[model samples]
Target: MRENSCSEPRLRKSRLGSFSKVATTKPNSNATSENRVICIYTYDWTDVADVMRIRDELRKLGITSRIPYKSDEDTMIGKYRVRGDTRISKYYE
Candidate 1:
C-alpha cells in the first residue's frame, strides 16, 4: 500500500502530460503561472506562418510553449476548454 501511494504521483503526472498535449489552451490570454499554462489564444486565428511568428514572440520572452499542437484554433478567453496541465505551482501546494 505504501509503495502504491509513492508511485501514484508519478503515474498521474505521466498521464496528465499526455492529456495536455492536445487541447484548448487555458485561462487568461497570455497569462502564465507556475501551475498555469500559457494561453496563446491569438494563435487560433493566426495562420501557420503566423504561429511560428508568435512562437518567436514567446521565445523572445524566454517562455517555452509546452503544448505545440495548441498553436491554433482561435481560442477566445471563453472558448478554450483549458485542459492544459494543472501541475501544482502555488506556495500552499
Candidate 2:
C-alpha cells in the first residue's frame, strides 16, 4: 500500500494576552502554504471586542479571517472560537 499522503496538523500555542491563548499551525493544503492557521480563545462577550480588534488589524495587514463560532470543547474559556490565517507571521510546521 502507498504511504498515507495526508498528515495531521501540528499545533503550537502561545499566550496572546492576559486572557487570550493563540494556537497556530501550518495549513495542510498546498494552496495555503504561505498562510498559517490561527485560533484565538476568548473568555466571553467582554473579550470579543479584543478579538475583533485583532481581526481588523490582521485584515489591515492583508491577512484573512473568519466569523467567530462556538467551540465544542467544554474546557475552553467561553466556548467561543475565532479563527484566522496570516501570510507573514511565522508558525511551527
Candidate 3:
C-alpha cells in the first residue's frame, strides 16, 4: 500500500521580511482632554492647500486645528470648547 505525503506551501524570504515591517504609532499622543475633534473632507490632494488655509484662519480666531494622518479623504482638525463662544460658521461664509 502507498501512502500520500502532505507538503506545506513555501513562502519567499522577501515576503516574510515585508510582513515583519509594520507601521504603528503611539496611542493618543496628539490628543488632549479639553478639545473636540472635527474632521474636514477634501476632494483630493490639490484641496489640501485650501484646507490648510482654513486651518490657518481658524488658528487666527484662537481655535487650534491639526491634520491627522488617519485618512486620505478627511482631515482631522481639533477645536477647543469655550463657553458661549465656540462657533465657526462665519469663517465658512
Candidate 4:
C-alpha cells in the first residue's frame, strides 16, 4: 500500500432554494423565490493535469456548474453566478 496519499479535499456542495413561506411568513409580502447553490471548487494547483482530471471527475457526476475547470487555470479567477427569478422583499410598513 502506497502511503503518499494525494487526496484532494472534499468540497461541500450547498444547494440554495427559495425562501420558505411558512418559515418567514410576511403579513403582506409576496416574495417566494430564490437561487440555486452550486459547488465551486477552484484553487491553485501544482500541476495542470491534476486540475483537468479533477474537472472531468466533477463533470461525470452530472452536476450543473459554470466554466471549464481545466482551462481556467491560466486565469485564476472564479466567481458564483445566479440567475433565476430573483426578487426583493416587499414589506408593508
User: Higher lDDT: candidate 1 or 3?
Assistant: 1
TM value for model 3: 0.29
What's every prediction's RMSD, in angstroms? Answer: 16.4, 12.9, 19.1, 15.5
For residue 82, model 4's alpha carbon misses the true position, in angstroms, by 9.6
Evaluated at residue 66, the lDDT of candidate 3 is 45
Query: How do the residues 3-56 of candidate 3 rate in per-residue lDDT, one tens digit apiece?
Result: 111101101222111111111233444444444344333344355555555455
In TM-score terms, candidate 1 sits at 0.33
Question: How well does candidate 2 score on lDDT at residue 86?
Answer: 30
* Whole-model alpha-carbon lDDT for candidate 3: 0.34
Task: List the pairs of residues colliding in candidate 1.
Answer: 44-73, 44-74
What lDDT tens digits, residue by residue, belong to model 1 across residues 15-67?
21212121233554534443533333332333555445545544545655454
Once model 3 is optimally superposed onto the true structure by TM-score, how far is the C-alpha of residue 29 displaced, in angstroms? 16
User: Candidate 1: where are CA atoms >4 Å away?
Assistant: 1-34, 43-46, 65-67, 71-93
Highest TM-score model number: 1
lDDT tens readout by residue for model 2, 1-93: 121111111112212222223334434332334543344444443465655654554454454545443332532433221233333222211
Candidate 4 — which residues are off by over 4 angstroms? 1-37, 42-46, 64-66, 70-93
Error of 2 at 46 (Å): 3.4
Best by lDDT: 1
Q: Summarize candidate 4's per-residue lDDT along 34-71 as a digit string, tens digits.
A: 43223233343444554555555545555456433322
